[model samples]
Target: MSVYHRPVSNIWWLKRKPYILFMIRELTSVFVAGYCIFLLVLVYKLTQGADAYGNFMVALKLPSSVALHLISLAFVLYHTITWFNLTPKILVLYRGEERIHQGLVAGTFYAVWAVISFMVVWLVLGV
Candidate 1:
């Protein structure tokens, strides 16, 4: 005879879901890739002819298409941040044979992204 026990305390984060989060985060990466490929294909089709371009726009009007884009946009935002957060683990940065903190690296990535975003907007909008 055996019994399983679940913790009752509200340590919060430890008690929360992980597998679901992992799946969501992984799916976000897939969406990011798929979204880019989809845009590329749409561009290619639009360049082919008016009929093909009309078909693409018609597909966009479908409910499934709208849902896909909405989900993709949400996932993409999460993916971007997660990618920055994971950069330190993937790359080796040693000033004098010592590893750096992941947060520091991720912060740097966020800073760079912000600066580039600002610059691009400034150039595009003439600000």
Candidate 2:
């Protein structure tokens, strides 16, 4: 018996807004993983000693490295915002038998994120 197979175009995902956004989100993950690996390398360099860590920091300040970091930061932000927006769909909340609004749920996540980020900045700056 022969199986029926549907032909699909290479750029099929680009045809729709949702598909394009989904593809962009998936692509952002690569940059996110790359950034994670970069952070891990930074940690490793720190463990190697002060001189190695200092050199690593110096390298990171180079124009090419700064550009790469900026690009990665943009992708990471896109990935994070998209995922947070999706949180409501993935997690349904209830407040005493009443279904909570999706916007509220997503906003809660953003609020928590902002609080944590502010705390991190405060700690890092020692202010």
lDDT scores in order = 0.85, 0.94
List the pairs of residues colliding in candidate 1.
none
Query: What overall lDDT, based on C-alpha atoms, would model 1 receive against the true structure?
Result: 0.85
lDDT per residue as tens, model 1, 1-127: 8888976654444455885576678788788889989989988997889999999989998999999999888999888877888888887677787788777888899999999999999997999
* Model 2: residues with Cα > 4 Å off, grouped in runs: 1-5
Off by over 4 Å in 1: 1-16, 50-67, 116-127
Clashing pairs in 2: none
1-127 per-residue lDDT for model 2 (tens digits): 9999998999999999999988999999999899999989999998999999999989987999999999999999998899899999989988999999999999999999999999999998987
How far off is model 2, as Cα RMSD?
2.3
Lowest-lDDT window of 10 residues in candidate 1?
Answer: 7-16
